[model samples]
Target: MTRDAGRPVATPSQTVGPFFHFGLTANAALGTLAKDGVRGERIGLRIRVLDRDGPVPDAMVEIYHADAEGQYGQAHFDGFGRLPTDGDGTCVFETIRPGAVSTRADGAQAPHVNVCLFARGLLRHVYTRIYFSGDAALDEDPLIALVPPARRSTLLASQPSGEPAVWEFTIRLQGEGETVFFAL
Candidate 1:
């Protein structure tokens, strides 16, 4: 590539990854949050990443959120976790359910975990949120209200049958049933 006159030529864009496992995974608390004495209901968050074809095993999943009391950065609560997907395209985080976050004086945001997805073929990572399926606050969340009712389910993480403590969320990068990624 060469400069044209005084202006530099635009280069073609490239995908962000094939992430280097060592750099992203080194010395990281990969998927365990809620260490002992973190006051909240302990639960497992199971995340699956998929493309139009099938499961995506090479993706990295990260989540950060408020603690059980809607407070973040507490000494005992790390409030963050990151993990690479396994061959099954799944990663599980053992953490406590976050409490409802008060985002406004007149309303409260629903309890949710903020998620980021990093995978091959993406120009940059994408952001999303995972809301518990049955949370009553979901009906009133300002953010949730912004999403169309038909597409809102993509943001929900549902508990599997007989797995009361484990919630499963699937992220679809494209095609039908694609998960919604927020611009922010």
Candidate 2:
């Protein structure tokens, strides 16, 4: 039906964005979760974001976890961190290894860090969990049981053979070896 031609067409849809370095800084302190006097096994977490094309330098990563006592809401540790990826698609966090948090079922959960990712192509941020490699509690965690055996490795962060205190996790947005993101 040809009516009055005074209406404007709607704008085309677009991805989240490419706001890589608008307000982010390279400050190392922003990613530090462990403060002075906070006690635990000091460790370094290295996260990498990738896609089929290559590294996602503009991505931002956030993490939250409990303290060494398997507790949260402590006065010493805030247990939260946020950092932007660098040119190598990497962000490093200096945090202590968290203790195993207990579950509602009276069972212990694996020591893990909760992660959130935000990047240009995503309409909304994605959520995931980073479990430490060699944690015996992984066998009993209820959530880990839900994931398939072959894919469970995607949720684990591994310590390089020579780097005793450094753990690395890679998030692949597409193609092979993609990290397992959670629904919530």
Candidate 3:
């Protein structure tokens, strides 16, 4: 008789947290921005975050950004713009591509979306920013550079489905590919 030579396989375990029960509600701030006067058409962004075990139904995901012109001034908007995730841990946003921002360095900042995470288990919110894929400006982005090169893909948004103009991205809370977090 021959003994099994394969390495022992470990089953993935699920981790539970307190912030998993929060429900997403539409906010006036986000609503107004969606209808803001921007030249370019608004695109829908769907974000899904899976818990360690699987998809977290009630995960609270929030996305913030400026109008089509990429203006986030107080006069243009009031209160922090936030959109929550749906029942499937998915959040949808109707907005336009953010305009370029000036960075500390000589180069300009790339267009991107800022993401904030608040789940059942965590007491405070985790801050993460998502970048666009194939953006020529991404090469010179200062914020994206902060993240490790190996993990940069996690923050880049992908368009798996939907129209050619529409953009989509899925986020994994923990495990193989996790979104990159910032200090602030």
lDDT of 3 by residue, 56-161 (tens): 6666666766555555654654214555556677766666667666655777778777777777665567787777799898888887887789999988887765
Better of 2 and 3 by TM-score: 2
What C-alpha lDDT do the candidate models reach, one value each? 0.90, 0.90, 0.68
Q: After superposition, how far is residue 60 of candidate 3 from its true place, in Å?
A: 2.0
The digit string of per-residue lDDT tens for model 1 on 71-96 reads: 87788886999998878889999999
Instruction: Estimate the TM-score of every prediction.
Output: 0.90, 0.91, 0.76
Instruction: Give the clash count for each candidate.
Output: 0, 0, 6
- The C-alpha stretches of model 1 lying farther than 4 A from their native spots are 1-13, 26-28
How well is each residue in 1-184 modelled by candidate 2, as lDDT tens digits? 2234776656668897678467777666879999888999999999999989999999989999999988987889979999999888999999999999988889988999999999998999999999998898999999999999999989999989999999999998888888888898
| lDDT: worst 10-residue window of model 3 | 16-25
| Candidate number with greatest lDDT | 2
Best of the two (2, 3) by lDDT: 2
